[model samples]
Target: MTTFTLEPQDNGRLQSLCGAFDEHLKLIEKEFNLNISRNNFTFTIKSNEENPKSHHEKLIQCAIKLIQDLYMETAPIKGKAKELELQNVHMALQERRMLSQVEPERAKSDVYSSVIKTKRGVIKPRGVNQVQYLHNILTHDISFGIGPAGTGKTFLAVAAAVEALERQEIRRVLLTRPAVEAGEKLGFLPGDLGQKIEPYLRPLYDALFEMLGFERVQKLMERNVIEIAPLAYMRGRTLNDSFIILDESQNTTVEQM
Candidate 1:
């Protein structure tokens, strides 16, 4: 059995860590395949196995670390401890998966420093890759985010672009993606070049519209401040003082790129 007591325990912080009816603790128990029991701020952890495996120590350590991390999060930010949610617990656990690979100090700094506030609310990176990706975009003039879908590659880029435009660091924002079909063939599709390509660039536009609002995004597009650059039409364009985003650039041919 592994046991530990949370230090300098405050009722609110302990409550936040364990969650309502100890749901957070239950989640940890489920995730780590362990049984957890608590008496006040003190907790015990034991493997569910009839006999603990050799690697059970490592497993217990990971569980303890997660609990400690969650407890740290419960520290009062303004005056009240940040309430623990299931989602927050999941993200904290996911983000720490890279703890061995990434330097903790740097990752923590990058995450807090690159917070992106939009029309919706403040946006923070979920994991290590995202933290590093945002840091790269903020630091480098020409930065590329290569990641799988739903990894916030385009979302973070749009956030950075909107922030730059809002700060007057860039004149305008230009969004583009190679109009390559993933499953559906393009020739069979209806409408003009713009109409057809709009579907390809919809993700970029959605991110923009979410951050800037529909009316504001439309006004910007109308004034040519925010442009959707089809791969074919971008050959002769002289873009200066702009935040140009080339989403799905991998689909572009070498000549087009």
Candidate 2:
């Protein structure tokens, strides 16, 4: 068992960090499969003793750090604990741990200080994986980012695409994703083919919107400089001088790929 107490002991901040009914702590516990007992500002985290230096231990440590970081922020956490938020925390923990374990030579090679320039400002890699991902996209004919959700795989890809487009390295940007619904039928949804697939492609749209702004994105779409479509529509089409991004690629079938 590893135990520690947050400093100053502010009840309201502690409550905000833990959430209603300690839901946030429960989420961390469930994710790491550990027991977390809390008394005031003190927390005790316990896990199996077989592996003293397990990933779970690291997760707990990272979770504690995240909690402290959030508590110190000016804004307080509100509402119910969200799964996406927890997943992002977990992803950050994984990235931090991965970077710590990277060999010195590999770290030197993988580290990137270059930032991707966009209309929104500059986009930089948050971790070694992102640095390598961007490097691969810039160097290779085709690059893929495979990871769980909230890992910024799709977001970074879109950023790289946007940067490439801004630099005239690619004349156009093509964004596509498999039209797979999560326990939802496509026919049941309203609108035409494009409308039906809009939800699936919304993430890509959001990234583009953030990078290039709404008006510019709309104009680009009108001119076909930025094209968004379903993966099914990509058949029999040859792409050249285009930055293509396929999001939610795990849902894609073998034929779609």
**TM-score against truth, every candidate:** 0.64, 0.60
**Model 1 TM-score, all chains together:** 0.64
lDDT of 1 at 185: 73
Least accurate stretch of 10 residues (summed lDDT) in model 1? Answer: 104-113
lDDT of 1 by residue, 87-189 (tens): 8888776766664466657644645345675554446677667887888888888998887888899999999889888888899888887777666678876
- Candidate 2 global CA lDDT score: 0.74
Candidate 2 — worst ten consecutive residues by lDDT sum? 74-83
Per-residue lDDT of candidate 2, residues 5-114 (tens digit) = 88766666676667667776786677567788988888888874566666677667766765665444313223322222444445545555566677857754635434
Could you tell me the TM-score of candidate 2? Answer: 0.60
* Candidate 1 total steric clashes: 0
Please list the residue runs of candidate 1 whose C-alpha ends up more than 4 Å from where it truly belongs after superposition.
Answer: 1-101, 108-112
